[model samples]
Target: MERDILHLTVPTFPITLARIAEPSLRERPVAVAPLTSERAVIQCASLEARAEGVCEGVSVY
Candidate 1:
């Protein structure tokens, strides 16, 4: 008996985290929130936030 493993492969399209980080976005907490003027909800949390139990789909109200 063998267990199945899920896998995915992408060709030609590559994303490297190191290249996307700017001086301000480096070595700090980062997240992608919805565009807003007032207090907006949290859409996704960064690696730092994940370490603190924050994650995607977390309500911010």
Candidate 2:
């Protein structure tokens, strides 16, 4: 017998959910980061944000 498996991913899942909940977020640069830290890092960023140089692991200053 043989088995098969698949994997999937949404790079900007957090930003996607935010845009879904807030229609206004559509068509805008969006990024997800921690709010409780002085130096926060971007966990995920939308396409627009990425185009503007925002990306995961980048510090959000």
Candidate 3:
């Protein structure tokens, strides 16, 4: 017997949600980083940010 599977994902989920709440953030480089410090690690980055070389686990500073 064979089985089928489905996969779904929301890339840069936070940014997506933010854009939903704030229309201005749409199509912009949005990054979700720790709110504690300037050197805090990036938790997630939108496609626009990734194109600019920003990535998760990288320092926001």
Candidate 4:
């Protein structure tokens, strides 16, 4: 028997959702983080943000 599987993914889920909420952030360095905490980690980073060395798990402060 043979089985086939397909995998699909969004380029970047957090960034995609952010851009949907705020189109102006598109082309800008964007980081997905929780605003409820003063010391939250960056959950995701946009392409522009990564270019500047920003990444997931980075400190929000």
Q: Tell me the TM-score of each prediction against the true structure.
A: 0.45, 0.79, 0.73, 0.73
In candidate 2, where is summed lDDT lowest over 10 consecutive residues?
A: 8-17
Cα lDDT over the full model 4 = 0.87
Task: Compare candidates 1 and 3 on TM-score and give the better one.
Answer: 3
Q: List, residue by residue over 1-61, the lDDT tens digit for candidate 1.
A: 9999998753211212532745565545665556673656666556665777766665565
Regions of candidate 2 where Cα sits further than 4 Å from its true position: 1-3
Error of 2 at 9 (Å): 1.7
- The Cα local distance difference test for each model comes to 0.54, 0.90, 0.87, 0.87
- The candidate scoring highest on TM-score is 2
Worst 10 residues of 1 by lDDT: 10-19
RMSD of each: 7.5, 1.8, 3.2, 2.5
TM-score, candidate 3, is: 0.73
Which lDDT tens digits does candidate 3 get at residues 1-61? 9999999887678888889999999988889987878589988898898999998998766
Candidate 2 lDDT, 1-61, residue by residue in tens:
9999999898888888899999999999999999998999999988898899887999878
lDDT of 2: 0.90
| Candidate no. 4 TM-score | 0.73
Which one is best on lDDT? 2
Those runs of model 4 whose alpha carbons end farther than 4 Å from true positions after fitting are 1-11
